[model samples]
Target: MIGIADYLDKQLRDYGIKEDLSILDFGCGQGNYTIPIAQIVGGNGKVYVIDKDKTKLNQLLVIAKKVKVDKTIEILESEGQFDFDLSSESVDLVMLFNVSCCIIGQDNYPEFQKLIHELHRLTKKDGKLIIGIKEGKTMLNRVETGIPLISKEFKLDKKEKGKYLDGEKLRNGIFYSLTKK
Candidate 1:
């Protein structure tokens, strides 16, 4: 049986997460994508993972060390808000997979959009941003309303059928690859 990390790393490579690129996994929880992405990016690259949850951050650190990819990652703790201290336009890729889809409802959509705008600040002029939204035709806060606000902050470069990390499983979702406009 394929473990969750192995499965996710394969999915990430298939989705074209390249090597030697600095990345930010915002709201990173428990090293799901953080560990695999760190491995993919290798020794020359870095994955800056930020999460408000201490437990999750600690768990992720443990996993990273166990996987021998801890050197490629820089773990950070936040106050569970939109604010960040990273320098502007520092990373090659920014990933918000499975982070925005949950809280974006009929209301507070603006707040979610604000987060996207902040991401825009963190992305390099030629860098890419990736998001994974759950598959749905009618838009349960995933398809319809989410993209427009994000479009304001990023240009849709490409999209691929991919899985987002959900707990110990990889769930069905679409990965949107966007670049600055």
Candidate 2:
């Protein structure tokens, strides 16, 4: 059984994540991507993990400690809003994996737009924003509809379609690599 961290590592490498670059894992849940990202970034780089759930952040810290990469991971607790306290152009990579659709769903378009703008501000010039959405009817619909809005703030670099085994299920998804323009 492949773990989610391993799956995320493969996807990130496929999307061109390099070493010694600061990263931000927005909506990071339980450090799935955070740990791998920290490993990729090494000691010189940093991976900022942000999520609204404190419990999850704590779990991420423990995992980081267990992995002996806690120094490379910074945990931040969000207020369930797009308002982040980080400086502009502070990070080289920002990941919005499997969470953007929830922000842009039927009742959250405004929040989604706000997050897009905020992400743009947080990303360094030429930095990358990678968005991954699970390939499901509802999620696909939301991503397609939201792409236009997202394009206003980011230039779509490229996209890749793929699948990964998640426990007993094969989860199909698309990875959108967008650049700050």
Candidate 3:
């Protein structure tokens, strides 16, 4: 039932990122996976979790306090628009977990391009972008459209589909990771 979070944590640990590494979870919903990441990064690291919905973030703040890791999370309310207030080349790792399509929607809106550009702008040269989109979604379409908006922004390293069991059933999802190149 909790396969996604476990799998994501395993993948992140396998990468051998530093404990003090700065991470950003874009469109983090309810801090499900974000909390685990925050725990792994430890007190020395800074994990910035952003969601467009302020109420969801408020709930996460409460949960974070309960877990006593609230200090590590810089929860912020941000609209999924181009005007994301962040300095360039700042973050080391950015996780776009099931969040990109949710933010831009399926109307072929150019904001997807702006989002990718902003993420790229906020990433260091060696930063990695980890994205997990649903099986049937607009991420691929957004990728097609995003090419022209920001040339050489990011390169898709690998993508795969797998089933994680959920209550005696199989729940399928697609996972993809990219790096700024």
Candidate 3 residue lDDT tens string, 25-138 = 888877766677788888999888888888888888888999988998996557755556777887899887767667557655467777877889888997888766666645
| Candidate 2 all-Cα RMSD | 2.3
List model 2 lDDT by residue over 79-151, tens digit each. 7888788889999989988788768868577788899899899899888998888877888788777777878
Q: Where is the poorest 10-residue window by lDDT in model 3? A: 162-171
Off by over 4 Å in 3: 1-5, 15-18, 137-151, 163-170
Model 1, span 134-161: residue lDDT tens: 7776434454567777786788878777
Better of 2 and 3 by lDDT: 2
Q: Report the Cα lDDT for residue 50, model 3.
A: 81
What overall lDDT goes with each candidate model?
0.79, 0.82, 0.72
Candidate 1 Cα lDDT to native: 0.79
- Model 1, residue 176: distance off in Å is 1.6
Q: Alpha-carbon error at 123 in model 1, in Å?
A: 0.8
Say which candidate scores most in TM-score: 2
Q: Which residue pairs does candidate 1 place in steric collision?
A: none
**Two-way lDDT contest, 1 vs 2, winner:** 2
Model 2: residues with Cα > 4 Å off, grouped in runs: 1-7, 164-170
